[model samples]
Target: MRTLKKVGFSLISIILFALLSYVVLDFLVPKSNSSSSENEEIAQQQSRVFLDLVAVGDSLTEGVGDSTQRGGYVPLVADMLRTNPNVKNVQTANYGHAGDTSSQLMNLLEENEEAQADLKEANIITLTVGGNDLIRNFRQVGLNGSVEDFETTIQEYEENLNSIFSLLNQYNDEASIYIYGLYNPYHYYFAEFEGLQAVFDLWNERTVEIAENTDNVTFVEIDSLFNPSDAPTETEVESNSGDSLEDIQDTNHPYLFEDDLFHPNDSGYKVMASALREAIEKELEDTDSLLSMNR
Candidate 1:
């Protein structure tokens, strides 16, 4: 009897211990799951929720060289944004017009009520200007045009660009604005004219300065992506003994449209779209970091 009692007691003790262990494990498993779920929720919160993109400006934004007539980088960016798991949906409003200068864009911004409404609702705004302005100056003066010749044009462009930013802010202070920098399309035509390249560089510099001054403004540079060149200037041409224009000029640039050789072809627009997507992602990541820090 004593042996039996001892055996029973041992069995009971073992059963109790096993039950307790099971209960403890069950509780801990749930807690772990809850913690993991909470972490997932936090991560989701850090991601951008939605994007309402508004594209406004000149031929690039208007998708001039796009063979599909799909509005060039505008649609491409929207498609890219949709791939983000956090973004539920994406809507785009294209206000892009061909041959619009900065001043003309500003005027449109001030005058177009519909565009103003769209701006107010947009979360992302992309502007492409200054190309027409530069091209106009280039057309007027040609390769012989001095840097001084473009100074006046750049100054005017600066004022117009500032006004454009002001108008955008006035219409929608909450939206992030992205302005594209000008590329030297004429690089192919005037590779030896360092003056034109200098003018293009100066224009981009002024544009960057303007963008820096404005809040929530990002400048996207497409110069080097499409038309990268280190061709000799007029002075370099004079000094070099054996270098020919054909050697310096890269006529094989595949990005340019064969018809005009000025506008970006389909492949070129894809490049621009990629740049815009990267810029948007970077900006959003920075914003997420700030939000995480604040939390």
Candidate 2:
């Protein structure tokens, strides 16, 4: 009878301890969740200010895929930014061309009346123009009938790229210029261009080195964001709705292109948008922390 009494006491003690533990955890959990909410609040508080973004490049920057703010990455990024009270009223300027090479882009930059006006108000710029340069170089190589053609093309590319960066920096001394690394779109679909991925890497590495020497400049890479499955099988929306890429035009140009299949599809644009969104958030977070430290 005495042993039974001891057993009953032991059981009661165990039950009491468990109840205490459960009560303590219940109290702590809400506070733990609130910490995350607090962090988001801080981020929101910092985002009330909007930064102006100016983008220059080929078709990718032009919103050829899903139609930009109406559709593609830039608009999505801007929308996301606005959600964080820290970022409000973001505007983007698109300076993109369908068949623009680096030299052509340089000419366009020199002639842009809007860019001149933009110099006064632009705070951020993103660039993704060099891919066309690679295409033109490769085309010239094919026409010239020698591998040596690539070397000359690269030399020209180097000079033009340097000048473009300097020009962008010159126009916007206070702006943060984010340049995108070239994507190997050829390798993305065609089986023959496997080695070109290395070429693209080398090109991106060079751009990174160039950006490293400059201040308030960063190079974003979208190659990693893409997968074979992410590529869109559909054509880009045309200038006129009826003139789509579904009809075969020529060997150099196919119906799969609004201008060219070389440009990204709507799916590709979404991928670009996703990558840009991540970049913007990370960058803003870092900037907010820096501002706090300064305070």
Candidate 3:
């Protein structure tokens, strides 16, 4: 009987020990989770150095071209980079209000307000500005429906851009600037607006000149990317979709591609993001290759 009693007591103790271990583990589990979350955050922060990128521009920078959340390509591009361990945590402050010209963008930078606090940490930038100026110029010359007088339009455009470039150096010359070259939207409207294919071509020519003058700046030639000749009419809007350009732009201005007639649809912005990614990848790869070669 005594032996039987000893076995019972041992069994009880073993059960109690198991229960206590479970209780202790339960308490520590939350701490483990907390530590894991912290580790993940650290890894994210360590993945990329561009923790802040301040984008100042017109509607495209604000993401007006696409019909998705985050509206345009910059955020999508940011999300794309954020997925890789070597390229995550690239943050941005998007100040791309609708109808803003280059001069207005300069003002936004100068003010350093409205999430302005984020600007100090900015390490890179992407923007598109010349389009609105050209449209406005076209309107002034009564070529509102056509791009007839693109030469005079381009001349004024260049002067405004020079001012914008000078202003950028003041903020952060170290930041790499990626400028999307002007698009060929007029072809979407008029094939030859008022005898002005020359004007449109000249406008792009000036941007190439602008890109050449600035050392840390490069032109992401978006003109050909949106080509009706090679690409379809519509574009894809979702961040993760495999939609084509022909799927996005159908009307004079898709609400997704443009907010009213002036801005781009969300789909348009998606295309921009798609284009921006190609440019950035090439640049970063070139930089890495050059570094490896020197070593």
Candidate 4:
């Protein structure tokens, strides 16, 4: 009877110790299932990709030239990104205004609440500036004007551009900026005016330098697209308008320019949109490559 009681006590003690140990371990250690679920949730969140594009610049961005009067390249880009399999969601905002210069853009960015919000949420940004800056100056001092005259303006533009970039980076460091290089509407009309082209080249070179130096910035070239090898025939120009050659120079490009000859027509907007899409596709590919390498 004593031996049996001792055996029974030993068995009960072992069971109690086992139960106590299980309780202690359950209290001390995290649950593996819950931990795994949380990790999965975090991973899923990390894997999701959203694209929000914010366009801030001049009339071209405002869809002024587009006969359809849609949202210009902003809507086109948004649509493209939405169709992209990698992008889970896409949003876009356009802050373009006619006759807006780099200085104006800087001021708007600093003061505009809506621009600030859009920029803060932007994953991509586009700019079209320096056209009005140069063109307005050209009107003030004809094509023969000395480069010295532009020195002050160029310096101010550079400062404004730097401030713009700084503000954008402050708002969202990851946002990619695509700045459209100025195209010479006067290329056909002023082909002989080497100084005019020279000015454009210099300005574009500086803009390219800025973009190259900045992170996530790209200079989109549209000069060649506007200035094709085969110039528009006299008949084409005459048919469109009876205006003199010089007067029609701006409005000559049937494909690219709107009736005003300055802003991009719908087709012109498409060209810009295509260029942006290509850049974005390249960026996505590069990202994918990096991710694969990481994996």
Pick the lDDT winner: 1
Q: Give the C-alpha lDDT of model 4.
A: 0.79
TM-score of each: 0.80, 0.67, 0.66, 0.74
Where's the lowest-lDDT run of ten residues in candidate 2? 248-257
Residue 126 of candidate 4: its Cα lDDT? Answer: 88
Candidate 4: segments with Cα more than 4 A from true spot: 1-48, 230-251, 288-295
lDDT of the structure predicted as candidate 2: 0.65
**What is the lDDT of every predicted structure here?**
0.83, 0.65, 0.65, 0.79
Candidate rank order under lDDT? 1, 4, 2, 3
Off by over 4 Å in 2: 1-47, 67-72, 142-149, 227-260, 287-295
Per-residue lDDT for 19-71 in model 4, tens only? 99999999998889989899987875565467777899888888888777776
Candidate 1 positional error at 165, Å: 0.6
Q: For residues 156-267, could you state the per-residue lDDT of candidate 2 as single tens digits?
A: 7778878887787777666767777776555433434445666666777778888888877777787655534444322432333445444424322221234555656666
Which candidate leads the pack in TM-score? 1
